[model samples]
Target: MNARIRGIFEDAGVRGWMHAVSLDEPEASVELDADAVVPMASVYKLPLLAGFCRLVDLGELDPRERVTLEPSARTAGPTGLSAFADPVTLSLRDLALSMATVSDNASADALLDIVGLRRLAEILESFGLRRTWVRRGTAANLRDLQRRTGVDDPDAALAVLADNDRTDPVGVYEAANASAASARDLTLLLRRLWAGELLSASQTEFVKTTMHRQVFLNRLASGFPHDGVRVAGKTGTFGALRHEAGVVTLPGGAAFAIAVFTHAARGDFRQPRVDAAIGEAARVAVDVLR
Candidate 1:
């Protein structure tokens, strides 16, 4: 698998770097700049969702707490949750579904509003990740833009962002200047969740179920299907970065965590090099562990 994945990196033009690790089998691995911090993109949403579920475990917020999705909460992106649905209210749990299952930008954005970015950053820190950050957009770019206006509005930055690109939280703000983590850290996260350790047992189950319901239909899911292999993962994409991190339970009951991150700038995501690299890495992970 390592040789295959290595070949894939070369064949696919994985530009700046690549890295992968296994949770169930510690000895299985591959890397390039394994310690480097690149843009995380949507992968940050995983930690954010886990942190929110953690809050629920503490009884601080009800998973089913009802909230209304006003028009302002919507954003343009690939999502069934944020789409043409009329003004509707849903429980926090349902909102989480949108954020995870369908990659709904509005749902993810609104969840950030509810969970707060500081808490998410702290959650990763508590989980022993040294390089992960969930920075707020306002903290990232607001003060300079707000100069002379003598006004501070957190919502102002979020409103104009992508409606115009920038943020105060997770709401489509270019991830606040490159939030990132190593494949090793991401694998650790998946391993923990697979073991029902990230949140309370029930919430952990919810997280797992949400992962199983992922709608992307590509990446590791399509590439690594082997009869009963169950994939539960999160993928992130941005300029120069494409990543997928998750746990796979093989047909033989062996489970492993695999994460692949690349910094390919020239290749369109659909390019053979990109898919071949990702597919090859996952294929290697399966062979080593399963």
Candidate 2:
């Protein structure tokens, strides 16, 4: 089964790491380099969201507390409050929603500021997710990229990382310098999440609902496009890496928590084959677990 999954990844021009376990029967699983730590990219928001919801449940933070994000204070990104010219005010819960559904960096960093990075690390440690580490939010990551490349412009620094001739000084593709996680750890987190062990019932539902509403579905959702088969996933991308980790629920009620992380052989911006391979590999893993 591992060999078959690897073949799918190779055919798609990427190296893959995956872990899938039956939520209904946790004993059943499939893994391929699932324990190796790799960069989390936007998927770092997963644990961030968890910590946010946990705080809300604990009453340490109010979900409905509204805050206005000035343009200068917001992190630049392609979506959400970052794209808005005027100052935008929203409740903390709505910010979390935007972060999860659209991978909004501005919303994520804002939430990170509210929920300290140290607290997130503490939360993961408490959960016994030792191999998963979220070192910083997206803004910090981009800043490091700029500093590493000695480029003032974020986009130019990103392009330098994309250049095959240059070795990435920021090491964004590796586990150490950025937020990183093992597939096993991520799947375990998801298992507990789906089991309502991570947050209050309402908060768990909020996280699940937010993830289910993710706008980008070409990766994991492509494999489970059949009617009534719902996929609640979060995708991560950085340079050559592309990943999606989430729970897949079948129409018959069987569910699996799967995490598929890949690094492509090439650095092309658009790799539809790699994206589809994520879904296809996930389908295969889920089928085996089923």
Candidate 3:
């Protein structure tokens, strides 16, 4: 099974790290380099979401509080308020919704500001996720990328990233310097999230619903196309790195938590084969666990 999954990743021009476990019985599992720390990319938003919910549960934050984000002040990104030309106003909870559903960088950075980096680290520690940590938000990360590439523009930095010969950008691909986690740690987070042990019922449901509504379906969701098989995942992408970690529920009520992180051989912006392989490898691992 391991060999087969490796072949699938290799065929897609990527090397992968994966972990799939029965949510109800975590001991029943499948793994390959699951301990390897990799860049979290947008997947870091998962922990950010948890921190947001935690603050709400603690009465430290009001989810319905409105925030006005000016276009000039927002983070740079391809989606959400980051792409909009005009200022946008939304409730904290609605911002969280945008962050989860669209992997919106602007929304996420706003949430990060509300939930400080130190507090977020404490939340992760509370969850016993020692291997996971978000060092900074998207805006800081992009600035770091630009500085490393000696480019004034984020787009030029991205162009430099496309060159395979360039060094790994610190806050983008280097696990130690970026938002990063191991596959096993990610699966554990999903397991705990599904268990509803740390969060209130309403917040848990809110997160689950937001995750289920995520717009991108080319990675993990691609593996399970059946109407009866429900998949809720968060994907991450940076240069050659692509990842998705989520929970999959079968029609029979059996559930599994899986995390697949890959580093592709090429840095092309659109690597459909690598995306499909993420799903395929996940399906294979889940099959073995089943």
Candidate 4:
């Protein structure tokens, strides 16, 4: 398993680590410097969503409650709520869907505002995520936006990110303000969710289903066939750092959580090797469980 995973990383020119864990056997797990902290990139959104759900659970916010998106609230890029017709109005449920399904920055920022980052931090503490730090800044979502713009430039793209400093006050964030997570904790989070210990089964199912909509699959999801093997994950990338972490459910109800972080050559965040390493690590978890 290590050899296969190593080959994938070597092929991708990724310099980092991989961790794997199987749900069928709680005591068994794999680590490759899994304790190391790494920037979360957009993977921070999972905690954000979990925090929002906690709010809903507490009756502080209503999932069906309607909210407005002011022009000022309108940040741009792959987000549904942000790019929707100006002054868009939607329920919290819709907004969360937009944020998770597309990694929508506007939806994320709005939710962060509603949920509050400090409270989110507290929630992570309760969940036992020590290194994961999404605190507060600008275009922290830049990796995705940058990739999108480089491939799909527009008249309004560059200026928006250039003004990312406005994101915190205006509701954007830089990667630094976001928290970091280790490969091990990330896998533990996934394993717990799949085992129905992270949240209520319904809540866990919501997260798992929501993550399945991730449109960008060049990383971990690219490693395995989408059929019998299911990869439900969140990805994070900044500069040359590439990270993808989540649960992989294989045939016969076995599941494993794996997180892979890679440092790559400039402009190689999308390299296939890093992605393959993530896949191989997940495959290892499945093998162990079987």
Highest lDDT scorer:
2
Q: How accurate is candidate 3 locally (lDDT)?
A: 0.89
Position 244, candidate 3: lDDT: 92
- Estimate candidate 2's RMSD in Å: 1.3
Q: What are the clash counts of all predictions, listed in order?
A: 4, 0, 0, 11
**lDDT per residue, candidate 3, 76-127, as tens digits?**
8888888999989999999999998888999999999999999999988999
lDDT of 2 by residue, 1-290 (tens): 99899999989989899999999888889999989998989999999999899989889999999989999988888788888899999999999999999999899999999999898888888777989999988899888878877999877877876777767664556678889999999999999999999899999999999999999889988998896989999999877889999989999989999999999877766789999999999999988988
- Give lDDT tens digits, candidate 4, residues 6-85: 66667766666778777778677766778877767667777787777767777788989988888675655545665677
Ranking by lDDT: 2, 3, 4, 1
- Comparing 3 with 4 on lDDT, the higher-scoring candidate is 3
Cα lDDT for residue 276, model 2? 97
List clashing residue pairs in candidate 2. Answer: none
For residue 86, model 3's alpha carbon misses the true position, in angstroms, by 0.6
Candidate 3 residue pairs in clash (backbone atoms < 3 Å): none
Better of 1 and 2 by TM-score: 2
* C-alpha lDDT (0 to 100) for residue 290 of candidate 2: 86
